[model samples]
Target chain A: LDAEAMAAARERHLTLTKPPGSLGRVEEVGARLAGICGECPPPVPESPAVLVCAGDHGVLARGVSPWPSEVTAAMVANFLSGGAAVNALARTVGGRVSVLDVGVAGDLPDHPLLRSAKVRRGTNDLSRGAAMSREEAARAVLAGAHLAEELVESGGADLLATGDMGIGNTTAAAALISSFTGRPARETTGRGTGIDDATLALKTRVVEEALELHAPDPKDPLGTLAALGGLEHAALSGVVLAGAALGVPVVLDGVVSNSAALVARALAPDAVGYLFAGHRSAEPGASVALEALGLDPLLDLGMRLGEGTGALLAVPVVGGAARVLSEMATFSDAGIEG
Target chain B: LDAEAMAAARERHLTLTKPPGSLGRVEEVGARLAGICGECPPPVPESPAVLVCAGDHGVLARGVSPWPSEVTAAMVANFLSGGAAVNALARTVGGRVSVLDVGVAGDLPDHPLLRSAKVRRGTNDLSRGAAMSREEAARAVLAGAHLAEELVESGGADLLATGDMGIGNTTAAAALISSFTGRPARETTGRGTGIDDATLALKTRVVEEALELHAPDPKDPLGTLAALGGLEHAALSGVVLAGAALGVPVVLDGVVSNSAALVARALAPDAVGYLFAGHRSAEPGASVALEALGLDPLLDLGMRLGEGTGALLAVPVVGGAARVLSEMATFSDAGIEG
Candidate 1:
């Protein structure tokens, strides 16, 4: 991010039509975009693309989530058919959806939008041992970065959004957030897919056990991620890094994506500059991760659904923020007294 | 509002291939629209229109606002020329913008978008006496109602938003909110248009003095409106009533529109059901009025710009909420487990 460009955008906001600081978060997002692009009056993100990385977790063997691992690949098929909530919400904002099968337990059919790049069927249970080897984690991250680069360059996407679809992904997310933020498992764990009180208690204990089993150092971010049991997490974090390197903004969804962002931030501190917390999730883990990342979410609709649904809603908001800088007349242009 | 239709919409949301309650406030809004329209999966507000009521306040003589009254007329010109924040924002959502000159103090050039229906140039200074006669308040409100009706019927607007452009209007809004909500003037008054601490104190004092002089009963809503000095408030309240009568949702801008909503609620309690508090303003009085109206704002972006810009931004959210109900496939249709 360029400090000079951000300062210039802030100064330009005061000169625009509205009163100083009236646009609030929108103004801040505009300034941040300017800094990201190093351009005063940054280009409006006209085309936003969403990447839904689907993986299965072996932690489901621990009964972390009630749904079978098969649901992950099923949802991917639903996404391909444009029938899921993510598809409906993406259409609302003129966004294109692309699904990446990083590691789904079941097979998905071929489709134009589907990028089948499965590293493995699923991860090993994190509670017992490392989910995957460090080398495998690096491969998954590279796959995500390559796809994100393709989306921005060839797909004509100006904005990127991170999405995840794993049956027990939230359980993995809680563990990753607890490890990265150094917060207690109880604070980071939440009810994934509306679990009972007994299940929540069990989930929290599982996260605590995983952290204790592999007290991964936060400084070694990739190792921490590899210690965790989710291929999509590594992949989503890859998109964040790729977006920062490409100077395109990446909007984050709820808990799953936010946890991935923590990993992204750990790997590349500058990646946080290219991120937008699209909406605060109902999940407790999301708030902890967002706070650790120092991000103020643009929308707080109490949505916890992943599949990039929450972040997709914020695409127009980001576009509108840019429009305010580029479209609205200044005080001088309108001939109004300063 | 039909309770049965709302119940059907709520039930439908749970089956829309997402987890229950994951969509948050969008779910609530979709059901509300269903109730208002007596239809399951109510139509998306495809053509939302914003009606900006431009007026002037006689209370400007008492130093309530720093900006000149002429700025109101100039801004009306800005709106007509598509050079204001509201214009840029409305364009972002594919919404049409219409300006009604309910009571600007200066002459405005004829424009196709401008509906000249001035209810006197301004109002009398309210600190000393009534700003407008009871008859004028009713007329201004009627004008607002007529414009709202036209926007919906002829302009093909299914969603309505209230906007204001009077220089010293927030001072008048504070007084009205205090009167209708039964809150003290100091609690209701706020920093309208970024006033200094000294001016805020003076503005609070002005509201208190006006309330004390009239002691307008909340039961007589029109009389209370007459006792207040802003023409836009009456007209904006009229838009609220007309929207309710037309069975279309009305999105409110900020403190000014919120105060007008309070008046609309006082006149007809059912009108509150048709209103959407678009975004909470930075003004303190907005919270007090929203509490009185029992409306949850869709966005809390810390914006105080009151040209319907805040509400206009929420138009897509409202539309998307409806689309979720209308366009999304059910879990049964997608063959997902119930």
Candidate 2:
């Protein structure tokens, strides 16, 4: 990863057979990897792991979503049954999808995809109390990072991506973003699931009230995160830490993930380099969060439906970038009169 | 597939997990395959084959490209070296990339990726005469199809995507699109490798003139394709036919590919349903070609670099769709109170 290593990696990439610079961004990633790993062709992870964190938000009682709190548990049931879109996408990509019960109000039955790691059934409603104690928040973050680290250290995964399942979590994300960036609540809240104008306006007001009450300190990033973080956010931040520590790629999906990454970067600025922004979420906070983190989203489809869908879609792009670096032709080896 | 078989396949898809109608077009593809093959969880190909056809256009002699015809050979060198972006992507996706020399004018050195099956050194300039005689055209199409059939029936490839490597081939595609759609050449021509306004004007005029000379009969798509087809076009048409005969998937890449698919559909309309438009090309004619074939493009990224970059990006999407159908939960299994 040093200058000498990077230059050597670049030389190896330039020696591959193809037109110089024909593979574009893909070649750059390959060369960067070669330099970092100090190998001609670094092995792409044959096994990728996805960590899905589930939680409940106290803000659910505030009527931010049209769907009831029970929908979160219901969808979790769907995920456990291997019926969620994420399951299918993971299977298609030959990656394993595991669900962790970071926190949820309802009791979750034992099932294959479900990983019972609840921090507490749910965080305290931020409008009324500290969402979670700083100690509990740190535990949730460590839990996420630990799971990913276990997979990588066991040689069970080459890379990791974080997925989330929660109701009113968008409110949690908006609150976290507002706290972290010192942005107004209105700037960070949007129609989470096609909410009507009147409901959106009301939701914004509620967020604004919460922001006013919390008045979280931006200088203390983790403190702000813990004060307003959903259990899933903490877990995702952990996934990012694990990826960075293990020197593996971690794809961050949507708003909840973006917030987690913002916190992760606060903890370790170098961690941002290990992350790939899969796509821009329809959530208003996503852009602000990504901007704060300084990352460009790979896809933009006005998609708000989370459950790791956008991240899953961007998997190929990530894979493609790596592939280009590993396989593209250099100017000379291609045997052209260039 | 028979009516009963098709009905059973349809039943299988409707029963899979996630929402009943969430996956849209992917659901239809899954069902149709199930019906056609009469297998609920159809065995996916362990080895997917990508057939990249390389050819040269006589039109390049007219000074239409920023790079010389030699760049085609240079890129073929890249493909053989396993250094092309497509090569890397295919490796990442666990597939093999093969090159077919259908009609390059130059002699290529023996290499592993290159498969020599040239019908001629190159096609005749369409501006002066038909690109290939009808007999030669049929031979080329059948040759590509035979290779595809061999991959599935003998080489054990379950899925195949058609890619092309040829300079000046886009001009040939524009002429074919204009002839097939009865559209103006100006509307169909686009900058290849970001050509300047002056060169683009020349390319457009050349295509218009070629279309007038061919005066293709829309009712007879084969005749139209034969008049304007590059060697790769004829070969790609063959790939589509082979896929249809073998009942496998053939993902189409860009404009030249669109023209070939149009020709393939004319040969057998059922082929259209079997084909998936991988992505929309930045080339102006590609959309028209896609529309004429009545297919939906999965991704659009203003990519005109060709070499099947768009299709390579889409390999994961098709794989993901299949995974969703095979792995996701059915509503009955999730135990939700739906």
Best by lDDT: 1
DockQ category of candidate 1: medium
Error of 2 at A75 (Å): 5.6
- For each candidate in the order shown, give its overall lDDT on alpha carbons: 0.89, 0.76
RMSD of each candidate?
1.2, 4.2
Off by over 4 Å in 1: none
TM-score per model over all chains: 0.98, 0.84
Q: lDDT per residue, candidate 1, B159-253, as tens digits?
A: 99889999999999999999988899989898888989999999999999999999989999999999994889999999999999999989999
Q: Taking the tens digit of each residue's C-alpha lDDT, what string does model 2 give over A8-95?
A: 6566655654334444444555555554444556556567777888888887777887766676787888877667878777766777
Chain B TM-score in each of the candidates: 0.99, 0.93
lDDT (tens digit, per residue) of candidate 1 on A259-291: 999998988898999999998998999999999
**Model 2 chain B — which ten-residue stretch has the worst lDDT?**
B16-25
Error of 1 at B186 (Å): 1.1
